[model samples]
Target: MNIKLWIDKGFEILLDYGPKLIMAFLIWVIGNFVIKLITKGLKSAMKKAKYDISLSKFLSDLLNWSLKILLIIVVLSTVGIETTSFAAILAAAGLAIGLALQGSLGNFAGGVLIMIFKPFKVDDLIEAQGELGIVKEISIFTTKLRGLSNKEIIIPNGSLSNGNIINYNTEGTRRVDLTFGVSYDSDIKETKSILMSVLINHPLVLNDPEPTVNVSELADSSVNFAVRPWCKADDYWTVYFDITENTKIALDKADIEIPYPHQVEIHKQN
Candidate 1:
């Protein structure tokens, strides 16, 4: 008689919960399919919008997990479990995590802004936050740069996005500003001519804009000529160094003196 009673109880429990269990299982499977479809559609949209690869992947993953969590809550409720409290707990936990990672969150938002706006991109030369470098990689929270000295520099995206950014490659060319000082007695016309020649002879210097040489300052000891040269962005440094070296050589060959301080001593006889 006890065995029969136990068997009846088992059947009663199964009858009570079987449909709910089956419904919850169906919901889970269908929710996952819908979530996948949503994620795939979002990825397609982001791709059409030309979003950064890293940003697209990150956002897709974020959406996937959030949807999975919501689906879990729905399945739990379908299985006769109260989920209002579960959602509330999740909200509270999310709030706590947000508070703890406030700075990181800001950086993540900044990175999203950067990827959307495209202020700079990988391999582009940029100056921001007093650091100049080629953009190496752009991540969700930080930007990596290959510094001029070949050092790797990592900058938090929050600060980088907020700060002033100077993108050198936008115009495809750069002006190299240089100043050369010659002795006060040097002929201004001759000095300008020599400087102009140095610019024209350099292979990297651009000629369309026409390089310029003008007297910028007349100091006590020397006359300063501002020499401006235009070159392809990638050739800026090469042109700058070459012009400087060539100017010195050309000036020396022409017998023009670069002034230097001289100390004269007079012997006193007692």
Candidate 2:
């Protein structure tokens, strides 16, 4: 008699919950399929919009997880579970996490803006946040740069996006500003001619802009001539060092003296 009662009780419980369980299972499967289709469509849209690869992947993953969580809540509700409390719990947890990672979220938002607006790209020479370097990688939270000294620099995207960004590659050419001081007695015209010749003779210097040599200042000990040369962006440092050395040689060959301080000693004989 007890065995029969136990069997009846088992059947009664199954009858009460069997349809709900089946409905929940069906919802789970269908929801997953729809979520996948939605994610696939989103990816296709992003690709059409030419979104950055990292950003596309990150967004797709985020959407996928968020949808999955919603689907879980729906399935639980279908199984006769209270999902309002569950959703509230999720919302509270999300708020806490968001508060905890406020800075990171800011950086993530900045990175998204960067990827969308594209102020700079990988391999471009940029100066931002008091650092100058070639953009190495652009991630979701930070930007990596290969510094001029070959050091790897990581900067938070939040600050980088907010700060001023100078992209040197945009113009394809850069002006090399230099100053050469000559003896006070040196003829200004002669000094300017010599400096212009040095700039014109250099192979790397651009000729269209026409290098400039001007008397910038007359100091107590010497006269300063500003020498500005234009060159390809990549050849900046090379042209700078070459022009400096070549100017010294050319001035020395021309008998133009660069002034130096001299100290005369007075000897007393007892």
> For residues 75-135, could you state the per-residue lDDT of candidate 2 as single tens digits?
8988899899889999999999999999999999999999889999899999999999999
Model 2, residue 83: distance off in Å is 0.5
> What's the true lDDT of residue 133 in model 2?
98
TM-score of each: 0.92, 0.88
By TM-score, the best candidate is: 1
- Worst-scoring 10-residue span by lDDT in model 1: 201-210
- Candidate models: Cα lDDT each: 0.94, 0.94
lDDT of 1 by residue, 212-251 (tens): 9999999888999999999998888899889989999999
Candidate 1 is scored at a TM of: 0.92
Q: Over 4 Å off in model 2, which ranges?
A: 1-19, 47-52, 264-270
Which residue pairs in model 2 clash with each other? none
